[model samples]
Target: MSSSFERYQKRRLISSYFSVVLSIALVLFLLGLLGLLVLNAKKVSDHFKEQVVLTIYLKDTAKEVEVKQMEKSLAMADYVKSIEYVSKEQAAESMKAENGEDFMEFLGFNPLLNSIDVHIKADYVTEEQLKLIADETTSKSFVDEVRYDNDLVTLMNNNVKKISFWILVISGLFTVIAVLLINSSIRLSVYSKRFTIKTMQMVGATKKFIRRPFVWKSVRLGIIGAVVALIGMAVVLYYIDKTFPELEFLKNQILIASLFLGVFAMGIVITWISTFIATQRFLNLKTDQLYY
Candidate 1:
């Protein structure tokens, strides 16, 4: 009967340890996924910013020399990243490509105007900066008007700001929640060993000596959990990249590696803190409290 009782106790302890390990793995997985989302959000936002272009339409009667001068002025602008000159013929070809070859036949002569497409630097894509650029460009003698999708730009900026703010808020919330979960899980794991701790305490074991092994164990478990989480995150990201190759830009190897390192470090810190706190609480429990 005593042998059976001991076997049951041993099995329960093993089961509890595995459960705690699994819980730690899950928490670390969530942390890793959050890091990935934050990292890719910046990349995705920059891609949209890069796509924003300012179109400068030349006056119909403007001289070629004047247009050339205007283009040179724009090239010197601080915000200008690159400028592509689309002549009348190229504009016509672009229209044909979009609306089919025969569609341009209805318009007798090519009504498309020659224009310059300007890609602005990411840092200067704000509405105020764009408005300043538009004012400067339209003031040119050869420029008929400078136009861009203002509403779309505004929406994009707003969305980027909102999303970034919310990501930060959500990340903080998740961190707090993760700490609580880890604390609870570690506390439970240590609670099951209360009798052992009490016995050591009675044997005049120093608190540091009693806590050292548990702390080391927790750190090892944390590292293992973090590694598993990173593997899982990599698999998910790999599948996403395979399914949507257009997002290949988000698969920045260096950034992903940095995120992995961050997540692993967070896991180790959280586990160590949680374990230390939980062990301290258990160590203070009275002899009668150990029974509960």
Candidate 2:
């Protein structure tokens, strides 16, 4: 009977440790997910901006050589992300497909002008920057007209700012919630050892001496939990990258390393603080309060 009771107690201890580690890992996983969203926000914004293109139409008398030279010059611009040349034939083909009409056949000749589709960098997607770019492109002798949807560009910029602000707010709230959850989890885990802490204090043990082992234990558990959380995050990231190869652009080695370190540090700091406070409470409590 004595041996069986001892084995049961040992099992309970193991279960307690397992419970604390898993709880911490779960909280950390949530925090890591939020961090990933915040970090990838810029990449998402850039992807949308790259979809906006500025069209520069060429004059009817513009030679192919002159168009190519203009395209080369536009490609060299600092704000240009990419540029594609669309010949008159390609534009007509696209329009015919869209409208289901052979307009060139009806008109005897292709009325569409050759144009360059220029995608500006996200940083230069603003209306003022686009106007400046259009002005510069229109000044070229071979260019007949430069066009973009000014209202659409302004609307997209405004929406991006609003979306970014909301995302930041949500991320901040989640971080605070995670900290509180971690704190409560650590406190409960330390609470289970309150009796032992009280007995040590009654035996003339200094507060610092009583705290050393509990603090170290918490630190070790925190490290284990953090490492497990990071492993889970890596697995999630791997599948995400595999499914959406474009997302690979958002993964920076340095940034990922820093994120993992941030999680690890947070785990250690929260566990230490929570354990210290809980242990201090037990140390100062009257023996009668231990029952509560």
Candidate 3:
């Protein structure tokens, strides 16, 4: 009977340790998911920004020299990323490719106009900057009009802003919720060892002395959980990259690795802090309070 009792106690201690580790791992996993969302958000925003193009149409009567001069001016613009010159012939060919056989037959003559397609840097694709670019282009003598989807640009910018704002808000909220959840879990785990803590207290152990072992144990658990979370995050990112190679920007190996490391560090920090606080709280609790 004495041997059986000792075995049972050993099993219970092992189970309790495993439970603490598992709970910390789960919290780390949640933190990794949040980090992944933030990394991908930036990738998505850059993809949209890259699609914003500004088109400059040449005046019908404008001479070739004048058109070339206008194109040079646009190419020199600070916001311009690259300038693609679409001559009358190239424009006609592009229209033909899109419209098929019926397009040329219906038009009788090539109605395509000469234009310069400008790809602007992502940061400059804002309402105010776009309007300024348009005003400057139209002021040129050879430029008939600056053509871009004004409404679409405005809408895209507004949507990007809203998305960014919400991402930040959601991330912050999730972080707070995660901290609270992990703190509660740690507190409960420590409470299960209340008898051991009380025994140490009765033996005249200093609070700091009693805390040292628990604090070191918590730190080890945090590190293990962080490592597991990082591995899971890396697997997810690998699959995403394989499935959508077009999103190469998201797969920036160095940046992604750095972000993964940072998240892992953050997970360890959060776990340690929460566990320390929870243990401290339980240590300060009255004996009667430990019953609850």
Against the true structure, whose TM-score is highest?
2
Candidates sorted by lDDT, descending order?
2, 1, 3
Residue-by-residue lDDT tens digits, candidate 3, 1-292: 9999999989987787677667666766777777777777866776678678889888678898887776687678778878998887888777768877446577777676788899888788888888998998788787888887778888888888898899889889987887776667667667778778877987899888888787777777767767877777777777877887767745477877777787677666766787678667777888888777
User: What C-alpha lDDT values do all the predictions have?
Assistant: 0.85, 0.88, 0.77
How far off is residue 182 in model 1, in Å? 1.3
Off by over 4 Å in 2: 95-109, 247-251
lDDT of 2 at 257: 88
Question: Model 1 lDDT vs. the true structure?
Answer: 0.85
User: How well does candidate 2 match the true structure in TM-score terms?
Assistant: 0.88
- Score every model by TM-score: 0.82, 0.88, 0.80
Weakest ten-residue segment in model 3 by summed lDDT = 244-253
Model 2: lowest-lDDT 10 consecutive positions? 242-251
**After superposing candidate 3, which stretches have Cα over 4 Å from the reference?**
1-19, 32-46, 96-101, 237-262, 286-289
Best by lDDT: 2
Clashes of each: 0, 0, 0
Model 1, range 1-292, lDDT digits (tens) per residue? 9999999999997887787778888998997788788878876787678789999998789898887887797789888888999998898887778977755578688777889999998788888999998998788777888898889888999999999999999999998998898878888888877888889999999989899888888888888878888888888888888886756834578888888898889778988998899889888999998777
Model 2 residue pairs with clashes: none
**Quality of model 3 by C-alpha lDDT:** 0.77
Which residue pairs show backbone clashes in model 1? none
